[model samples]
Target chain A: MRRTSPISVYLSLLTALLCQLFPWVGQGVILRPDFMLVVILYWLLRSPNLCNVGTAWFAGLLVDLATGSLLGQHALTFSVTAFVALTYQRRLVLFNTWQLLAYVFALLMIERVLILLLKLFEGNENPGFMYFWPVITGLLLWQIMILLFGSLTRPKTN
Target chain B: MLKGVHQKLEPQQSPAFFVRGPSPFSRMVFFCALSVSIMAADARFNYLSQVRQGFIAALHPLEVLANAPSEWTRDTKKYFSEHNRLVQENYALKEQAFEQQIKLQRFNTIEAENTHLRTLLNGNIPIQPKAILGEISHMGRDPFTHTVVVNRGSQHNIKAGQAVVDSKGVIGQVTRVYPFTSEVTLITDKELSIPIQIERNQLRAIAFGEGNNTLDIPYLPTNVDIKVGDKLVTSGIDGVYPSGLAVAIVTKIQQNPESPFAKIVSTPVADVSNHLQLLLLALPDYKEDELSKVAPIETTATKKELSNKNTALIKNKAKANAPH
Candidate 1:
């Protein structure tokens, strides 16, 4: 099994929480990625034995409480993302970095779609294309986190 | 014996290493159910509000930690601002203070005279609302909604349901109050609405947020007497916002021959992007009863037409088409 202490995992999640809580106003709000989700998805994929679906659900609940949207909204999405990540966790050991990035991008897209569907159901007007900016930003954030924490797999040889 | 029982179960469960717990699908099912019920309890009821408040309160330290960098940057920027610019700003502010002092002197007498006239008419005296001055700590994390977290909340006696106004006009309402902060939902958000009157004619209407940065006024007839440049202000009917605060100005009006109602839009007077300081007008003492009373006033054909999401649109169109 890959080496990761539980304390470090929790600490990394806390760092993501702070980024998520950082006050973004005006156009910056549109660009703010799902920091907590990207981080949680990272840990979920890398160390599901330590940080499982329950942890992702709880992290998502914190986001819901923070955003002051419908209380369960983020919780639902985060749990589902965690599940998706877990389903592919075994295969992830063999997959290269590019394949991993693609997988993370797909996970973020699922989250955005979940939120959009929920918002539309709640009678909110459809926000236009700028809505998906967070997914792209999230992928970039995932890369940054990977660099900081070291990758799920070894860096490929030149 | 234990190893034999474990061996019998382990073979069925052992698909791969690290697969010790329940399947991901089962976990997903468990969590999704938990979340759905939580959502139902939250939206359909108020049981979780206190729970929510407690969790947010616990999160307050982390919020401050997150906010610290922005605070430092803002302060350093202020400290390093050019001397010439500071002088210019100070000079301009002094001039404005002098002008405002003159207005204040006149306003004091006008207010006294107005009170005397109101007493004579046996009208209820309107109390000047107490205001809590707050700085915008941060804009909301959600892009789909227009909300801001200010640095004042329940600990400071700031309550939910207060009317927040910036210097230019009404900005929004305080929807959530935490220990150290509150969320103000701007009037241009789709979920918020404010009752307004034409400053020139006092025609009452409700303004709805268009979700974009614009406000829509719906529900007036095709030939309502409103014109461009007409100012919309709070009508005071809702009791949440005090009457007569400037709201917006009619910006666009579309009256189609086929449609029964005219479409109107207005730009809010408040400039949220530029200004950070704002006033959270305390929710009036009598708001609950007043709101209940106003609920049943759909008495006329006009009231039926006023039910559109943007009744403010109609009011704006009328104001735009009217003679000033």
Candidate 2:
């Protein structure tokens, strides 16, 4: 197995941040995926040593700053999501491709729900069902990540 | 012999496999606590504004890069625009300017006469607020808030609380001013409210944003003379917005017998979705001497009296306008 360089991890995370900062107008804003979350989850599951809960927390902080949202809102949700992903990292090796995709989808949903809860607690109006659109888009990005960086599971030696 | 040799080799544990630092639970707990504290401080205090400002300034280069693609496309489209369409637009603009010039001639005399009358009545002169032109850089990132970021910021002498308006009417107010960009919270945001008066009847009321592209005028009586198509203009009593600027037009009114107060809703006149340019009106400056003379409590008392006088004056004007 090739060792993932820490620099590459940080570089990819930065690129994701840039994508998150892109100016999304009209419908694009609603359909925009959580780019930072997808990238962070990918690294956490593939190489826990290189990208851990701390990295996720820091990336969340950057996102919070960039989005101009309440401080630490994303950080808190992201750290919780990272912890959940890390808890199942070992078992993921035993899971097939479909199971791994389900796991990723669950993590994305968890992150979205946590954010919704926090926003509601902050007295914001309920964003409605359209708020969950990002989960579907984030899942698509997850698949893209797998394609670009290779899958987490080891290949069969046929 | 092989079993004995393997036993003698002793259990070899690779440090890399077991060196996962702190457990995930502990890390999660630590980060969660830190974030909660940060969130609390941000929500309840002013310390984080500076941090936010500094970070936004640092991220400005990245924002410009991200915005480059859209800017290029817009420029490209403009470059390919039809020459005939441009000529027609230019002709229309010229005719509009000619009509406005004719109105300006009459407005100049009326304004001068109004100042003279104000001096005769010993009323304080209204201050003309200057404005700075700004372009909308982009819509706000957070979907919960109806805000648009303008390119002008503190560096350009932009300040929080400045009234923003398009050529048509009032748009919003500048809520947060960063180094190079400012966030204008639209009048459609729930957090904002504007003091308005019915242009037809001069009935004064406060309009609160409904958050879904409408304004709600709550607490008004069911019998209040407001009707659909009535225009609402700023009263200027709050001193934030200039007087008589068109705000919203009444669209829907529901009189519920169960509820004492009528449910009045209106849509804003300014359409931000179609335009990119707006003017940020400077805050009206109060002279230091004038401010010192009036106590805060006395000011509030006078403000109440002034509103009462305004309503009474409106009634008299309405009565006079009626045919005997």
Candidate 3:
């Protein structure tokens, strides 16, 4: 197995965190992609040895801090997402692009549903249709991650 | 394809693959359980607030790094502004200052008289909360909750539970304080509730966020003397927000013959979306007697049988049954 340096993974995660922190105003904020989640998913798929469930859990904690949601809400959902993603990491090699996208779609949907349940239990009013907008935007961002950083599977050569 | 398959088969024979530690299934189950318990401990109890505060304090530098570009853009935009606009703005500001100076003279005398009157009445002098001025670092990342992170936090003596206000009115309350940043949950948030009085009739009611940038004053009768454009201000019975600060302006009132109560909606007067500078008022000293005072004040309105005393009992009963 080829070994990858840990520094690049961390740098990429930092960049993604900054992107998540970028100022968004008005309607654009509703459709803003979950940048940190997409990046953590990428690293979990690409280098499981370097970025594990613990790393994803830490990233979610940062988001919880940044978003100021309940302290452990995102951390709980994200760690579970990372664990789910890593479970299928090896089998992902046999899946095609459509299958990979579908898998990521499910992971993001789980995170949303988990957060929704938490919010409801905490007595929040239902957010309605707009709550799911991020999952669609995050899926679009996943494609960009694959295009720029290369896929999780073997590199293609002519 | 045949040659590539033969080459890839060699790694499968290696014994090192067997030593990849615990199966992913057990690890997944273990970690999932751990996270679930942590979530429960956080939500149902107060076990993790300190841990969260420390983590946020540590994350402050990264937040500033993220905020630098926006700060730079705001500064540069100021530097390259048109001279004509600047002159007009300067003139407007000078006129405003002169007008405000005249008002300040009258205000000083009125304030002194008001203090003297309160002393004679044996009323407790309202404590002036120390405020920390902070800029909105960003709107909340989660669209589900209405919150804003300010650049000032515990480092600036800002604490959770402090009231936040802009020039126009009450905006929100500080819910979380990190080292160099804090989070303000706006009055429009579902978890926030404010005690307010109708400026027209002085009918005091509690306003709760309906989650659409509007507040709901539930349980008031349909025949209540409230109209559109009525002003609502903090009643300050909660001892958190100071009394008589503007809160919202009535936008719509719906009376349903089928229901016992009128549906009133008001939009917050504070322009939380457009402004950066907000004052975080210090957390108040919680006094049990202040809560008890909520009921007595409700009786101040006189309808004979609907005397302020009965109104107070209604409030106390409502507070007992309320789902907050």
Candidate 4:
């Protein structure tokens, strides 16, 4: 594993925030990925020493502020997701490519479900089935992040 | 046993001693508690509004940077539009302006007559609200809520509760004001309710947002005098919206035998997504005017009392002068 700097994690998180802030209109909004969550998960998995639960929690707060929803809605979900990711950090080295993908998918689903529960509790409308559309897009974004930054698992040897 | 095995197996696998200050579970618990308190405080109090405003103000530059690409694309598209389209648009606008001018002429006489009639009835003059034109910076980031951010804000003299309207009709009301922008909650949001009167029969009722692109007018009798095509306009009773502004058109009416109230649904007239520009009407300070009206009534009562006293004195003087 390459030693990473703290600045790189923060810079990448800021770039993800910019992507999240992009104006998405009409039907496209439903498909908008949780860019910050995917990026934060990447750093948390890659360098837990530098990107910890506190980093995820702060990033979630920024998401909450940007979305202008209730305060701490995203923050709570993000920290919970970070905890799950960190708990499984030691076992990631043994995970194959498919297993890693499944792990990321579960994390994304956890974040989405947490948000849906929060929204429902806050008395928002059911938002229909389309509310889960972000999960699929977020999965795709996670794959892209892995492709760009390299995979978290070791290469298979014959 | 697994912990002993793991610790005994790999010393290098553990995180650096300096970097691992606290357990992830403890950090997660602390953050979760902190966020829950913040959520409780934010939902129950107004203390965080100032903090939210300052943070949003600081984020303005970043938002502008993010918006640049879309703005550039729109500008390029506008610049590349064909000349014929511009001419056609200009022609249509000219025709619209001409028709509006003709209507204004009739409106002037009607307004004068309305003033004269109101004065005869000792009614207070209606205040015409001043308006500021603003462009929608973006739709609300949260899709679950129906809100839009307008470029006008506290810096632009925008106050919460101002009426927002498009050319077609009332759009919504300003709910929050930041430094360089304000949040306008649309008429379709669950929290907003408007006082409306049917245009056909002048039946007054309050319509609430159902949060599903329709307004619900409940509490009306199941056999109320309303139809599917009836138009709803501002009743002006709440003093927020002026009378006769178009609000919505009745779309569905469901009368349930089991329930006492009718399920009347209406769609707002303003196409919130169709327009980029909207008008924010300034809030009317009618309370001060109402107080002034009360002051005049007191003065008039005192003057009447003085006249009654003078009349009694004159009557006594006449009796003295008549040598009775």
Please report the candidate that would top lDDT against the real structure: 2
lDDT of model 2 at residue B16? 82
Which segments of model 3 are wrong by more than 4 Å? A1-3, A154-158, B1-14, B283-324
Among these predictions, the greatest DockQ belongs to 2
- lDDT digits (tens) for residues B45-74 of candidate 3: 647767877876676677778778988999
Q: Whose TM-score is greatest here? A: 2
**Could you give candidate 1's per-residue lDDT for residues B1-324 as a string of tens digits?**
999989888757456664558888899999999999999888766568778889999999998899899999999998999999999999999999999999999999999999999999999888999998998888887777888889998899887677899889999988777888889989998878889999999899999998888998888887887788889999987667899999999988889999888888899999888979999998667553332333211112223433442467778899999999
- TM-scores for all candidates: the values are 0.88, 0.89, 0.84, 0.88
lDDT of 1: 0.84
Global lDDT of model 2: 0.88
Going through the candidates in order, state the TM-score of chain A alone for each one. 0.94, 0.97, 0.92, 0.96
Provide the lDDT at A116 for model 3: 92
Reference contacts reproduced by model 1: 0.85
* Count of residue pairs whose backbone atoms collide, per candidate: 20, 0, 3, 0
Model 2, B287-322: lDDT tens per residue? 223323333112233345545766898999999999
> How good is model 3 by TM-score?
0.84
True contacts kept of each: 0.85, 0.85, 0.59, 0.82
Off by over 4 Å in 1: A154-158, B1-19, B288-324
Docking quality (DockQ) for each candidate: 0.81, 0.85, 0.54, 0.79
